[model samples]
Target chain A: MSQIKPKSIRQVRAQWDGLFWTTMSVFGVFYLALIIAMLVADFRFTNWSDMTSLLSDARVRFSIWLSLISCTIAAILSLWVAIPTGFLLARLGSESMTQRLGQRSPGCRRLFNWARYFIDTLLDIPIVLPPLVVGISLLVLFQTPVGRWFDQRTGDLFASLGYAGIRGITYEIPAVILAQFTVAAAFAIRTMRNTFEQIDDRPERVAITLGASHYQAFSLVALPQAWRGIVAAFTLAWARSLGEFGPILIFAGTARMKTEVLSTTVYLNFQFGNLRGAVSASLILVTLAIIVLVLTRLITLGGSSNKGVIV
Target chain B: MISVQQLLLRQGDFELSQISFEIPSNAYAILMGATGSGKTTLLESICGLRAIAGGKILMDGDEITRTPPAQRQIGYVPQDSSLFPTMKVHRQIAFGMEVRGFSQTERNQRVEELASSLEITAILDRYPRRLSGGERQRVALARALSFRPRLLCLDEPLSALDGDTRNNLTKLLKKIQQSESVTVLHITHNLEEGIQLGTDHFRLEKGQVRAVVGKDQGGKNTA
Candidate 1:
């Protein structure tokens, strides 16, 4: 004898079959309304010339290029500096310092702890300090004698390579990159150090035992294992630098077709009542940001998957 | 032969003093202890990863107490089975050879030999994360052995494996030891494993060597 299927009241609802569809539809409607409103507003006052000129304008092109190049430079420098800092913080704990401190007095440990706290507070200053303040501080420091001396010593050739006859860190690409790096690297170091800390020390120890030296162990073992986290840190720093505004404005003044990065160009366009130019530049900025985000996601995902392939 | 003498170190709240031991040429020496009994510290001191506050380690009559870990020529397989996650199994096995300046041909040959012996030939293209616990241990062991060190030290080699896997790995380790004729200093808390593989066993307690026994029932109080 064949068995007959039993019917239950509201079987679809009871089984959660329709719940997903309903949930999706609710979110879909909200998203659709937002998109429709944006489209209507965009179409009502949209000027084709503004969009076209924004892309075709030499100044706008230069601004986009400048932003990309500076942000890339800042991000690379930050990673190069941050990785070592993070490694030292994670692997070399305060135990050695604590031992030395113990020789002096118990209070020294407390002092060292306070020092760590102070550094942490210093790191937090970037997040809270307005970008304009950061830029002004940089400008003030760059104008100092010591700063000029150091710059002349290190950047004589770089100055010669530039179109303008300028010496030391002021209103230049390097200055902008340096300011962004100063803020970005500290945050990157904090992020990467936390990640490196979470990884077990056993791997590096194992590598050393397997005949790899300190550098070999770090490069081949620790760095590779922590690749995903490092990539994430680099992405964060890069994105932060790309979006940087006030610091770039004050340190690297807005010179059209030269130092006019995306943010500054947009600001200048708005100030001059060139609404179309402003909107076009804003769109370009948004498009660049979206492309970067998508690229980062893809790269990170690929890197993580590559790590997973190792076993 | 590997010999340690008068080892001493201080790390806040714990002190290691006068710890000494010897493993004769090509013999398997098992170091037995509870956690925090300074077993790992002693191993690390020999490998030169940890600085000895006072003491000396001699391998084949050459002093290596002040040597860096990379130059020590001691193959170390840690408890966590540290396989390079970015590498394929083959590359992981060959990394030590590359570091030690071995020729590419020799590295490849050594990897092939180790992989086949460990029955991991099929997993050569796989990564460390994709391997099972036992497979990981096998690859880690293979990598360590590829270096052809004077001595191989394992810190709780089988501690991470399931019972069956541990038993199987013990057999594999014994086979590798016999074939390679390599000296070994293994640390473990497992009594059965100790009895099965150890030619001579030393018990450690509270930073001191308690006793040395030739052979006996597993886990008898040495002190």
Candidate 2:
């Protein structure tokens, strides 16, 4: 008997497959094209010769520098928190902590479940709640005694260091980083948690069996494999911090040449009816975002050769 | 010698209870079980990777029920070769010794010796991804045996190899076991291979254990 599919059957399958892919390609490619068109149109209306001077403007430069510095610092801190937190969440005994606690007592199990539920819900609050809500929450937090005490201690240290640029910890560079971290770290945590969850725990276990301690196993087996995911997480957090506006504006007041970041510069320019300046700043922001996005893609693609531990 | 008494473990819905066994020092014991019979679970428990509910694991006269896997000094090769992809073969073999605070010269000497014996000396610089399945298994074996573990746990070590490769490796493994005299807890579905190597035979069914065959001091079947 002939093994090949019948010509009529093949034709029918090909026809349906072609139609499905064509429909998918039409909408998918067009939406992406529209965004590209709009961005290109923004450039088309601009004067190329004046672009350099627009970017080199003192206020613009200061805003960009501030945004860069703050976002970088925030992202570093976010990763520091995210890596460990994400791993902990991912490794929290897939047997269910609540179920394991059942061995203790029924009441303790209930408490464990509630605690787990509360923590999980809290993780997504930054992403689920409105950005402005995060800003308002931070403002409300700093008014409390605990926050005031922390602020005073940090403020005292900075004041003693003779830094005239910083006023108080609440309305300065530190506040900017904190505001950015609150939101960016949430995204990074989700990313890294998913990464760790996807990875099999067998290699780490094997490492431990081979005379490596808990920390050694994690460092040797888990961390090395998690490098790509960590890079991706950092890229996302940094990009998100760059675009964060509400929390920074609400928590850290935009003081010109002090706390004024790029996002606030765009807002202030638009408010002052400096349409040209606003558009210019937005374009710069878009360009920077694109660079970061492209860099992440390249890094992911380049590191695709190593598939991590087999299990 | 390693001994397990009244071991109980629950993983999700599966319950392995009242498991008991003893493998004498420098003896090869084969644990035979069907699919989902909790053989791997028992091996992991022995290595201190699994949480046992009520049990005692005595190693060389020391009660190590709560010992960490690192302190247990039990080398484990899981069913699938889970070689760390980022490391070279040498690094994988040396990882144990490095973590155990062995000096550079000792680590290098042991790694090279194991690599040569395992026929992976040429591929020591190669990453796990570049190796063949059989080669990966050999590297895993080298890594497991590098630190001179008190007991070696092989979780279906030959399951992934071809007939010829499996036969050759079985002979090689037999030779290594004889020379090292490290207590072995070998899990396998291959009955013939088990009978060939095992000084003691144990069967696990529905999470329960039975002494199918026991061997005497002279390695003769006394079941």
Best by lDDT: 2
| Steric overlap count per candidate | 6, 0
CAPRI verdict (incorrect, acceptable, medium, high) for model 2? medium
lDDT, candidate 1, A230-249, per-residue tens: 77778778877877888888
Instruction: Provide i-RMS per model in Å.
Output: 3.3, 2.5
Relative to the unseen true structure, what is the C-alpha lDDT of residue A91 in candidate 1, on a scale of 0 to 100?
69
Candidate 1 chain A weakest ten by summed lDDT:
A302-311
What C-alpha lDDT values do all the predictions have?
0.79, 0.84
Query: Which residue pairs overlap in candidate 1's backbone?
Result: A310-B127, A310-B128, A310-B129, A311-B127, A311-B128, A311-B129
Output the lDDT of residue B139, model 2. Answer: 89
